[model samples]
Target chain A: DTAVSQTPKYLVTQMGNDKSIKCEQNLGHDTMYWYKQDSKKFLKIMFSYNNKELIINETVPNRFSPKSPDKAHLNLHINSLELGDSAVYFCASSQDRQSEQFFGPGTRLTVL
Target chain B: AQSVAQPEDQVNVAEGNPLTVKCTYSVSGNPYLFWYVQYPNRGLQFLLKYITGDNLVKGSYGFEAEFNKSQTSFHLKKPSALVSDSALYFCAVRARYNDYKLSFGAGTTVTVRA
Candidate 1:
């Protein structure tokens, strides 16, 4: 069974299109995170939510917003996507702040 | 600011030989160090972590990491390298007293030759 899963594994859209990527974890974790891996393979934290509460918000652009409906799901919505938004988005979850994080199969976003 | 650095961009080793991937970090308080591996077209997978206690922590697939506090390094090592073990490895860190976000290194690609 997949401990973490992201929907729309592959998303391809034109510039200025709005898109959303969904993430869910089944490991009963309280903290979830969103990460972006650029073309150079540098993984950076975009946002983190603990018990549906915003905990960490990096200097990501306001065009990107994260929403956590519950402790099990954290979804990312992109507004007016641009070519620079093309990269792989990863979803992760952990029991607490100091626990090892479990990552889901990333969603490859391609803004053409 | 908390950050992790992987000095080497790539490491090549022959099968059956020992291998090491270097990682260093800078944090204000006690650091939570972790190692993760990623294959092509896949997300990162947790390998091991050093929270406290022993300096050497063993992890999956016969992987182990040595935590050197003075040196501020947590290097991943394997006694014998396998071809299938080759992949992109990342070292991550998060201050124990800080937020839940983990800062990752630039990643090192390990290529084990048959």
Candidate 2:
């Protein structure tokens, strides 16, 4: 069974376009996170939500927003996409604050 | 802030040989360390973690890691590696008091030749 899943395994768009990536976790996790992996394979956390509430927001641009309608779902929306946003976006979830996170098949976003 | 470092960018090994991936971390308070492996075009799979206990932690696929508190390092090791073990490996750290934020290292690419 897929514990975490994300839609649109690949995404390509022009700069200034708006896009959204959907994520869902069936692991009954209480915390969810958004991470970006650059071409160099450097991973960084962008946002995190706990029980559908915002918790961690890193040094991301204001154009990015995360919405959690429920505990099991966390969606990332990027407005006015930039070329620098081209990277693999991964969604992860954990049972609590101090547990190993399960990752979803990442969405490779390409902003042309 | 909690952070992890994977000094090596790539590791090459032959089948049936031993494999090791080095990792070091820094945290303000106690740290929670983890190892994850990712195949091409796939998500990261949890291999193991060091929260507390016996310093040496064994994980999936005959993999193991030794947590050194004094050195602040957690290295992944496999006694006998197969070509199928080739993948991207990542080390992550999270401070005990910090929220759900996990700091990941620049992944190390492992290539096991058969």
Candidate 3:
């Protein structure tokens, strides 16, 4: 079974489209995070939520929003997708802030 | 600002040879360091971490790291290398307190040849 899982592993859409990536963790973690990995393989943190509360918001665009229905689930929704948004997005979780992070298989989004 | 530096973009080694991937960090307070490995087309897997109490920390897949406070380094080391050990390795650092967000390096790619 997948410890940390994300849906729609491969997403292809047109510009100006809206899409959402859903993530869930079965490891009983209280902290969750979103990271974006570009084609260059540069991974950067986007946002973080602890127990469904937003704790960290990096220099991400406003078009991107993170919602945590509960601790196990943290979903990312992007509005007005652009070609620049084409990249693999990863979902990760940890038991605490400084603990080791468990990452899910990334969702590769392609905007045409 | 917290930052991690993996100075080498890529490291090459032969099978059965010793390998080392260097990492250094900077933070306001004492740092918590970690290393993760990513194979092709897969998400990163946690390799090891150094929170406290140990200068040399060991983790999965026969990998270990030495935390050097004086040098601000946490270098990943393996006694003998295998072809499968070749992967993209990331070094991350964060504050010691809770709710700490990690700052990761650019990553070092290891290539093992026969």
Candidate 4:
């Protein structure tokens, strides 16, 4: 069974277009996070939610918004996407504030 | 700020031989360290972690890591390397009392030759 899964494994879009990526976790974790992996393979945390509440917003662009309707789901919505946004986005979840995180398969977003 | 460093860009080892991927960390207070592996076009898989326990912590796929407080390092090691074990390894660290976010290293590519 997949512990954490992401929908639309591959996303290709044009500049100025809005897009969204969905992530779900079956691990029953309370904390979920969104990370972006650049072409250089550097992973950076963008947002984190605990119990459906925003906890950490790592200075991401205002155009990037993360919504957690429930603890098991965290969706990322990007408004007016830019070419620089082309990268693999990963979703992760942990049991609590301090624990190992399980990651999703990742969504490859391509902004043409 | 907390950070992790993976000195080697890549580590190559022959099958049936022991392998090691070096990882060092920097943090203020107590730290929570972790090791994760990633295959091509996949997500990171949890390997092991060091919260506060024996120096040697073991995890899935016969993987183990040694936590050396004096060195501020948690290196991943395996007794016998397999070709299938080759992947990208990442080291992450987070302050024990800080937020839930983890700071990851640059990642080291492991290639096991058969």
Best prediction by DockQ? 2
Interface RMSD of 4: 0.7
lDDT of 3 by residue, B12-113 (tens): 999999999999999887889999999998999999999899799999989999999999999999999999999999999987763558889999999999
Colliding pairs, model 2: none
Q: 1 or 3: which has the higher TM-score?
A: 1
List the pairs of residues colliding in candidate 1: none
Instruction: After superposing candidate 4 on the true structure, give the runs of residues whose Cα lies further than 4 Å from its correct spot.
Output: none
Local accuracy of candidate 4 as per-residue lDDT tens digits, B3-99:
9999999999999999999999999988999999999999999999999969999998999999998999999999999999999999999998787
Off by over 4 Å in 2: none
**Tens digits of per-residue lDDT for model 3 on A38-108?**
98888999999998989999999999999999999999999999999999999999998668999999999
**Residue A26 lDDT (model 1):** 93
Query: Residues B1-114, candidate 2, lDDT per residue (tens digit)?
Result: 678999999999999999999999999988899999999989999999999988999999999999998999999999999999999999999998996889999989999999
Locate the minimum summed-lDDT window of 10 residues in model 2 chain A.
A94-103
Positional deviation of residue A5's Cα in model 4 after best superposition, in angstroms: 1.3
Judge the docking of candidate 4 as incorrect, acceptable, medium or high: high
Each model's TM-score, in the order given? 0.99, 0.98, 0.98, 0.98
Each candidate: what lDDT?
A: 0.96, 0.95, 0.94, 0.95
Q: Output the lDDT of residue B71, model 4.
A: 96
TM-score, structure 2 vs. true: 0.98
lDDT of 4 by residue, A1-108 (tens): 899999889999999999999999998999999999999899999999999999999989999999999999999999999999999999999997668999999999
Per-prediction interface RMSD in Å: 0.8, 0.7, 1.0, 0.7
